[model samples]
Target chain A: MVKGLLDWIDERFKIRDLWNDFADRPIPGGSSWFYVLGASLIFIFSLQMVTGILLAMYYAPTPDHAYASVKFIEEVAPFGSFVRGLHHWGASFMMVLVGLHMVRVFVFGAYKKPREIIWVLGVGLIAIVGGFAFTGYLLPWDQKAYWATVVGTNVAGTVPVVGGVLLRIVRGGTELGAFSLSRFFAIHTYILPWSLALLAGLHVFLLERAGAGGIWNAADRVPYKAEPLFPNQLFKDTVFIGMVFIALASMAVLFPAPLEPQADPTDSTYNPRPEWYFYFVFQMLKIFEGKLELLGTVILPNLGVAALLLIPFIDRSPERDPAKRKLMMAAGALFVATVIGLTIAGARAPIVNAPAVTSPSVLAGRAIYARNGCSACHGIFGKGGKIGPELTHVAARRPDAAWHLKHFRNPQAIVPGSIMPKLDLSDRELQELTDYMLSLK
Target chain B: MSDQDVSRRNFMIRTIIGIGAFIGAAISVPLAGFGILPVLRKKEPDWTDAGTAGDLMTDEPQERRFFQTVKNGWQEERVERTVWLVKKADGGITAFSPNCPHLGCGYRWFSQERQFKCPCHASLFAIDGKVISGPAPRALDTLSAKIESGKVLVKFEIFQVGTTKKAAA
Candidate 1:
């Protein structure tokens, strides 16, 4: 009966031809694991769309109920946690697969003359995927989401003349509130998803038109034999997708996505940190301070992205072999290393959470210390730099308050060879800092 | 084809485009308005009764939970909300928002510590809602409160967090 229905539909729509065109296409250089990244990305993207829709059924985008709605989806709805987990992990997987796919394309020089447009489309799709990560982040209305988005929108506010306008547009208002949450929801669920789908469809259509670039190392070789995509590329793609599914499922079952406390814009001690994927840029911002912040925040990042997008045009040479493309290969390697290095640095960066203390004076003193950049040179609780002696045990060594006060006033006078500069501060600040240092014991 | 026939065809095409554009505008204008108008309109303040002013103690903060009908978009529903009511030594009542000024984490009044401490960030506030210590950019947010017929009516408002100036959110 099902076969008869399919036949009946095929008679009107020519469904068999469509299946033949999709499944039995000739693939030059045949299938390899290197080619599976794109397939895996598409699979995960579809999974995300499905799971995302399910979660959206219960998610209220307003500030008043966003947190409650997410909680309902996670705890009350049947298989809600599972759906959320798949969606969560699916995002990360998409990011990873996109990166791998880009690398594969770059290594193979797949973005040659005929495929330049395809590469540009891929770059655009990457931006959309990033948009998904950013805007989707704020939907939960949790502390991490709120603060990270605050920092994210603030970064947009650093653009020279149009910065304020861009900030307002991105945030939907001056402050991150009901409108901001709703706007992010609209962008994440509606705008980005649809844009990605459209661009991704064009990208695949163009890829099919250009055909596979085939064996990077063997691009110069003559008359390449073609094999049918059915049971070959499809089989490999299925196996890899299955493996990814298992891995994502295991991760979901073992370590489900965490829900932090609901967003509180008033929590001053909470430091806004972006996701792991954004760690490289986050750490780069720390390196570029004050006057040079725009270099890290906008100029350099945009330049890098521009260069990535224009790779096919920039490297017009037709060479596809890695050995022949020495400059490009070296640059790619350096970029990867830098990203890994910065990510590690960001991971190890000191968490600036305020210590739990009841004393008002001590709290005041700690704030003063933080404001003065004492952490730059002096180590505290084994964190921070080691240029100066560790401040953790300073009170135990120097029990005199007057001595500490004198040291703050004139470091050189208190310790003749002391390299610590005498910080220009008022008497009240010195006293409070002294009291705080003593309380550290 | 005759000139008369061409003119007739042109009229048909133009009319088709005109009607198509009219239909497009008809659907899109309302859709855009539906999506954006609510976000732009100023939200009206709603006051909810907390409790009797006579039941509060001096120098102590009490948690008050009340259900207020919140009309968000098309949905009108009663949602549970909270406010910390502190009876001052001067026989006056001050209502404080539960959110910490640091990053918006809910804070609890610690009687033992004699301060309101946020669990997420440890921002401390004195009984008077002054910033005692930690990373709070400003003091605790105070809601507008008044006594009417021995009952306390509080108008809860969210302020922009992590800022020195208190701007309505």
Candidate 2:
């Protein structure tokens, strides 16, 4: 019965012939376990798609419900944690596998000749995968996601003339809020996925057309033998995929993804850091400041990508051996080293200090300050106006709390020609303001 | 092959299939149930104590801010909520939800104007929670309030904004 049904379908679809052709395809010389990275990445991506769909079944994209829905998936839904964990870890694995695959192709000189377009497609796939990660990172609507996105979008806002427009487009507005969350959710779940699927299809087709680049070692040339990609290569691919599945499963069970506290835009104490993969770029922002910021954030990164895309055009050599390609090898090594160094530096950077405590008197004083528009001239913790000295460490400089009380009542009494207005405050208001100022230290 | 050997092989196959089906069902049933359970769960109404009744002045509206623990799905968070408390002439208390009837922005009591004003869109409401002027579609939402042992407690509920009728959200 099954044979008859398959025969009926095969007449139109050529299913059996296609399977036979795929199974019998010839793998060129030097195909080994090293070639499994690409296949493994495809498997992981399939897993991510499955698990991501399952998650979207219950996820709510609104600002009020996004965090709550994720919490439901984590703590309430059965096996929800497992599914979410797989998707989360699968993303990281996909990134690592893509990197490893790119490295393998570069070292083997696969990007040299006929496979240049495939290499370009591979780069596009990497970017789409990265876009996947970035968009998905904000869907949880937690503090880490919120602040990281705020910083990430702000990085795009530094792109010279088009910066502001790009920022608005990426965020859907000037600030990160409901619109931002919804936009990210839509991109993560819809737009990027479809684009990635299409590009991935083209990428695989191009790769199949060019065939595997094969191992490039000089010593293994004589003994190298071409083999059919059936039981031999297929067996190895299955083993690698199985091992990866086990590792992913173990990771899903062991270290589930953490859902942090809900996002609070008013709370400035939270320190935002990007995911580990983005640490290098985040670190670059620190090294390059002011007008030179564009060099690190935009120009350099674009130059690197452009160079990579134009590799085949620049290096027209027929040489496939890494030993002969001394310059390319050295350049690749330097780039890798720089990225690792920057990532390490970013990871080790000091955290911002927490905001001061909000005692009753301090709260009252803060209210009084807001009411009197004191922040109009004096800056607090690097925010507000900069016409006057920063009041972040003001109490430390002038420890005598009574002086601030007098200054608020009459500014010229403390400093002649202070150009500051005198305030009318009750004794309790004066004391509360003094408490708030003293606490700033 | 002998008949007994064939029977034993068939028995083994049957056992394996049974176990596989059981395991599959075991994982899937609960997953489907949990996934749909949140949609079916009803939101339980809760009242939180605002403050002592003595703190409110007669015929005067005072803004009281307090942290209320709100539960949605599996997340429970303490969010600060503000309400306008008014002590009526009959010694009764009426609590108004702070969210404006215009666009849900928090409205504040303007002592000089003696009216509630939304800073976002300039919506104005009378001290008695009536719409006075501006873009407000209706009066301020009045929350369910009760006093026990001289303590004021209010049942806080969010209402749909930009509408003349008060509808719970």
Candidate 3:
């Protein structure tokens, strides 16, 4: 039945010839496992496409419904959490694969001579992937997503000349609102995907025309023995894809994607951190602080990308072996090392102006406040159960520290019908807790 | 390659195939559930107040248009719905769904013929909602309706088309 059906369709479409042209290829060197990275990336991209479409069915691109819709998908829809989990983990996987693929190509000297166009297309693909990550991050419209976009757009605003216009264009207004969510949704779902697809198609077409880079050390003069890519390379590719699938699926099942609290534009104390892949750049901003911030925010990153795109032409040596290209190889390794080191540092970096720097009394008061469960009703720094009035600006309401101390001692005496219980705390503890309360504002 | 090397490669391929199948199961199970579970789940009937019961008290079927707040996905949309209400000889109100049973076309109440005529498929339903003289497989579907405080309320629903049974679509 399948053969007859294939014959019927193949007669009209000539799918056999197309399949042969695509699959029947020869590798200059017998297929190696290193060639599997690109295939794994393509597979992950396909997975992302499917999961993204599924998510879009449930997602609403507006300020009012975006967070609630995501919540509904996660908590109500069947298999919604798992599908979202796959997409989230799949994004991280794609980033890692893209990096690995680029590194593999660079180390193999595959971007030299006839394959320069492929490298250029590869660079464009990388930028599109980065665009995907940035836009996809904000679709949840949560605290982390919103703040990260604010920081991201602000970073763009640091660019000279057209920074203001660029920021306004990106945000769709002076502040992130309905337009920002809708714009991000459109870009993430429509614009970036189409661009990536077009670029990737051209990249693969160029790759096929140029063929696999093969063994770099294979003497150009000699005719090296070649093996067909069918069972040899394809087997390796399938195995690698399968392995990646297992790891991604495991991660998705174990730790599904998280949805933080809804975005609160009024909260200034909330520290926003970019996704892990962006840690290097985030750390760089910290390194080049204050007046020199423009260097890290704009110049260095652009320069790095320009350098990468120009590498093949800049290093004009015909030698493909790493041993022969010592200086270039060293520079590449150093760059990779620096990025890794900075990422590690960023992960461990302490929060600026954290409560640790506060006076001893304030620190003791924070501990006392926690012990007394004061946060149950009164919220500070945007963290609390919030059953009562928020205490984020409590100091502004009651400037006198003595009033707080008195309120702690006797609730009904200070304010009639006050629901606050009289805490049996020591005088020192009361003083400390009051100090912590005053420090909030 | 040596015989041992071939065997090792085969074993590796088998292991990879096992993992591939595991991954397939993981994805397909969730995907199947995601697609099917929502469809299988029953939707609660949402009743909307169409108009005043006294206004619709007549022998002829009255077409009442009302806005219904419907929760579709995460959005709450106000959709315009129409229902044909008929005041019987006993004075009890019967609300008929506006669509033809054959293919879900909007049917009109023709007072001259005293029947609901569908323009799309030419299906005709009598004032009593029975198939008068057309290709309609069953009678016109009735909406769950009640009169409360001089207001006519209707619980709107869509039924499966081209079917003998009045199953909810």
Question: Which candidate has the top score in lDDT?
Answer: 3
Cα deviation of A126, candidate 1, in Å? 0.8
The candidate that achieves the highest TM-score relative to the unseen native structure: 3
Q: Give me the displacement of residue A387 in model 1, in angstroms.
A: 37
Enumerate the candidates' DockQ scores in order: 0.01, 0.12, 0.34
- Tell me the tens digit of each residue's lDDT in model 2 across A1-441: 998998899999997887787766777673478778888887788878878888998789989989989988998877788888888999989988898888888888988778888888888888899999999989999999999998888778779889778988999888888899899988998898898888889888877777666666534667756665654565566667767877887798899998999998876568788888889999998888656879988999899889888888888898889999999999888888898899999999898664554567877887887788888998774346768766866776777978998888898989898888888889999888888888776
In the range B32-141, model 3's lDDT, one tens digit per residue, is: 78766865777777778898988765679999999888876666789999999998778678998888999999998999988899999788888989997788999999
Tell me model 2's lDDT, rounded to 2 decimals. Answer: 0.82
| Candidates ranked by TM-score | 3, 2, 1
Worst 10 residues of 3 chain A by lDDT: A350-359
Worst 10 residues of 2 chain A by lDDT: A227-236
Task: Give the clashing pairs for model 3.
Answer: A365-A432
Stretches off by above 4 angstroms in model 2 are A217-220, A355-441, B1-169
Q: Candidate 2 or 3, higher lDDT? A: 3
**CAPRI rating of model 1:** incorrect
lDDT at A167, model 3: 81
Score chain B of each candidate by TM-score.
0.78, 0.74, 0.91
